[model samples]
Each structure stands twice: as structure tokens, then as C-alpha cells.
Target: MTVTDFDFICQILRQRSGLVLGNDKAYLLESRLLPVARKYKLASFEDLVRLIRVKSDEAVIKDVVEAMTTNESFFFRDTKPFDQFKQIVLPTLMAARPNKQIRIWSAAASSGQECYSLAMILSEMAAQLSGWKIEILGTDLSTEILDRAREGIYSQFEAQRGLPINLLVKYFTQVGDRWQINQKIRSMVQYKEFNLLNDPRSLGKFDVVFCRNVLIYFDQPTKAKILNNIAGLMPNDGYLFLGGAETVLGITDKFQLLAGQRGVYGLTTGQAAPATKPAAPGALRA
Candidate 1:
């Protein structure tokens, strides 16, 4: 593809999904969008861009944007966040909220693994959360992945990564060569199609949010906007989990690193009214 074609595609991605593509990413565009070009029976990437130029379709834009959006995720990705969540965050929150209700958002939840991981951890504390209300919301921009997440199935290799053997055995039943998260864990979470670039207020507020590993794609301004919107929906004492490589430092002041915790953040001050009970699972689908 010519530089002009590459730049056009990059512009389209940025407009559609807030992905910032640099001039050096020509190879990446070819690697990811070539198959999309072929799928539409276009002769080459140039032809794909030509089609978009002449007759832009919303579906085509969506396909190209989703094709470029990174959906890398796995169960308990990066051990420290889950450890902090299970060990300190949950305990402190439980003590503070005697109502015994918890709501968590797995932002950019690629395929529900992270959400289910949270469920399993909570389930392990079932005796303590026996009468409590718990809801896990898993949202992603890709409809296809959200569908897969709802199905609760994973390949052996996918399950092996970050999923401990004992927990895997307890929570998943082998189906032929693949593993499926048990219905009990699956029922505790719900999936929805969401975009971080859009306003997030409609999704309702969350006490614990897992918006991990997704902000690095955006430019600094876009990143700041997204972090502010995320903060807008969290209570003062709420917790936010970002990827280890991502941080709030030099980004936004809405959150600060939780005291004595790594990869965990808390609101700086002020509290939103706690979210009411979440609707039954499947009701929040986009």
C-alpha cells in the first residue's frame, strides 16, 4: 500500500475507534487489514481504501475498526491485580459496605475470562458473600468476542495461560478438547458491547473496575478523556485496576494509586451515590 492509502486507513481507524496509528505501522496495517481486504474480494489494500473512499458503509468501518482493535486478554492476566483484589480490596470493601453488595466492571473485557476470574475469586469466598449481591459486567467493542465470552468456552491453551490448574479443575468442565466455565460462574457475569470513546454514564456506576491494558492505544488527550469518564462513574472509595504498564501518573488526577497497593487505584475524593442493584443478567446487552 502507498503512504496515502496507509494514512487514509489510519485516519479512518482514529475517527472510528480512537486508535492512533503511526507512520511506522504500515507493516501492521498490511498484516491485519489484508485479510479484511481479501474477505471483501478486494484486489489489494489500495482497492479496500478505494471502496471506503467511494462508498463508505458503517458495517465496513466497524469491521476494519474491530480488526485493528487489540483484544489480547486471558484469565487472571497479570497476577498482582487479582491478588490485591482478593486479598485486600475485597476485604476492605466488605467491611465498609455492610449492605454486602458489589458491582464490578471489566472494561474492554475481551472474552469474559477476566470477569469469570473475578467470579471464581468471589465464589471462593462464598461463605462470606452468601447473602450478598454481586454482579460482574464485561464490556468490549467487539460483538464477536462478546458472543464468545457469553458462551464461556476456551481452548486448552487459552485456559492454560494465567488460569491455575486447581481453579481450572474446580471451575471448568472439559468439553472434548476445550474447557467451559461452569454455569455457576458464568451466571454471575454479563456481557455488553461498549466503546470507551463514548460516554460511559449510561452503563451505571461501578465500585470496582478492571479497565486494564486498553488505554495505551489512544493518544494522551484521548487517554485523559477516557480516564476522566471512567472516574466519573466510580465512587470515592471505588477501586480501579489498570495494566501494570499503564498508570495514572502524568495522565489524570481523578485517581491515585491505592495506598500500599500496586496496580490498584482509588478515587481522589468525593463519592457518587452507590449504584442500585444491577438488572438480571442479559438485560444490559447493547
Candidate 2:
């Protein structure tokens, strides 16, 4: 693609998805979008760019954006965030929520592993949460991935990634070579198509949010804007879990790190910290 075409594609991604692509990733345009071009029967990448520029087909634009957005996810990815949820967040919320209801959001929840991981945890504690109402909403920019997430099926390789052997055996049934999460676990979560660039107030309030491994893709100002928007969707005392490499420090003050917690943060103007202690560090891979 030409320089002008490259810049135009960058603008479309930033405006639609808040993703900021630099010149260093210029090579990705062809590697990723070429298949999209061929899928639409375009002659070449140049022709695809011209179609987007001249005719501006919304379908093509949507596919282009979805194609570029990274959807890398795995069961209980990175371990610590799920540990925090099970050990600290859930117990605290159980005590504080008078109505016995908890709502959670997994933003950019690629293929639903993260939210489902939380569901599995909740299922393990079913006796304690017998009378509670729990809602887990997993939203992503890609409709295609959200469909996969809703199906709750995974290949053997995906099933094994960071998922414990006992939980896998208990919660999943082998469908041919792929494993499908049980109906009870799948029904505990919902999926939606959402863009982080847009407001989240319509999704309603959440007690806990897992917007992990997503902010690192945007620029500084976009990062701050998205963080502030997320803060609005959460209560003063709600918890936010980011990727191990991401932080609210220097980016936004709406949240502050929990003392001794690695990837967990609570609202700055919220209530006191939870009484639970930090979990011991260990690898949780299967």
C-alpha cells in the first residue's frame, strides 16, 4: 500500500477502535489485510484501499478493523488476576453487597476465556454463593470473536492453556477433539459487541472489570480517555484488573493500585481496602 493509503487505514483504526498503529507496524497492513482483500474479491491491497477510500463500504471497513485488532487470550491468562478475584474481590463483594448481586465486565474479552475463568471460580464457590445473583458480561470489538466466545468451545490446545487439570475435567466435555464448557458455566456469562472508543454507561454498572492487555495498543491520550470512561461505568469501590504490563499510574488517577497486589486496582475515591491478604506467587499453568 502507498503512504497515503497506510495513513488512511491508521486513521480508520484510531477513530473506530482507539488503536494507534505506528510506522514500525506498516508491514502488518499487507500481512493482515491482504486476506481481507481477497475475501472481498478485491484485486489487490491497493484496490482494497481504494475501495475503502473512494466508496467507503462499511462492511469492508468493519472487517479491516476487526482483522487488525489483536484478540490474543487464554484461560485464566497470567493467573494473578483470577487469584485476586477468587481470594480478595469475591469475598469482599459477597459481604458488602446487601442484595447478594454482583455484576462483572470483561472488556475486550477475546473469545471469552477471561470472563469464563471468573465463572469457573464462581461455580467452585457455588455453596457460598447459592442465593447470590451474578452477571458476567464479556464484550469485544470483534463480532466474530464474540460469537466464538458465546459458543464456549475450544480446541485441546486452547483448553490446556493456563487451565487447571481438575477444573478442565470437571467443567468441560470432549466434543470430538475440541472441549466445550458445560452449559451451567456457559450460561453464567453473556457476550456483547462493544468498542472501547464508545461510552459504556449503557452496559450498566459493574463491581469488577477485567480490561486486560488492551490499553497497551492505544496512544497516551486515548489510553487516558478510555480509562476515564471505564471509571464512569464502575462504582467508587469497584475493582479493575489490568494486564501485568499495564497500569493506571501516570495514566489516570481514577484508580489506585491495591497495596501488595500486582494487577489489581480499586477506585481512588472508594472505600477501604479489602481485609484479605495477598496471595502467594506461583505459576498456575496446566
Candidate achieving the largest lDDT = 2
Candidate 2 lDDT (Cα, whole model)? 0.89
TM-score of 2: 0.96
Kindly list the per-residue Cα lDDT of model 1 for residues 1-286, writing each as its tens digit.
8988888899988877899998888989888988888989998888888888999977777888988998888887877677777766777788778888888999999888899889988888889888899889999999988999999999999999888788888889999999999999999999999998899999998989998998889999988999999999987889899998899889999988876566788888944223333234322111
* TM-score (all chains, Cα) for each model: 0.92, 0.96
Residue range with the least summed lDDT across 10 consecutive positions in model 1: 277-286
Off by over 4 Å in 2: 281-286
lDDT (Cα, tens digit) per residue for candidate 2, span 1-286: 6788899999999999988898888898789999999998987889899889888999999999999999999998878788788888888888889999999999999998998899998888889999999999999989999999999999999999988998899999999999999999999999999999888899999999999999999988989998999889888879999998898888999998887777888889998465567566642322
Model 1 steric clash pairs: none
RMSD of 1: 6.6
Each candidate: what lDDT? 0.85, 0.89
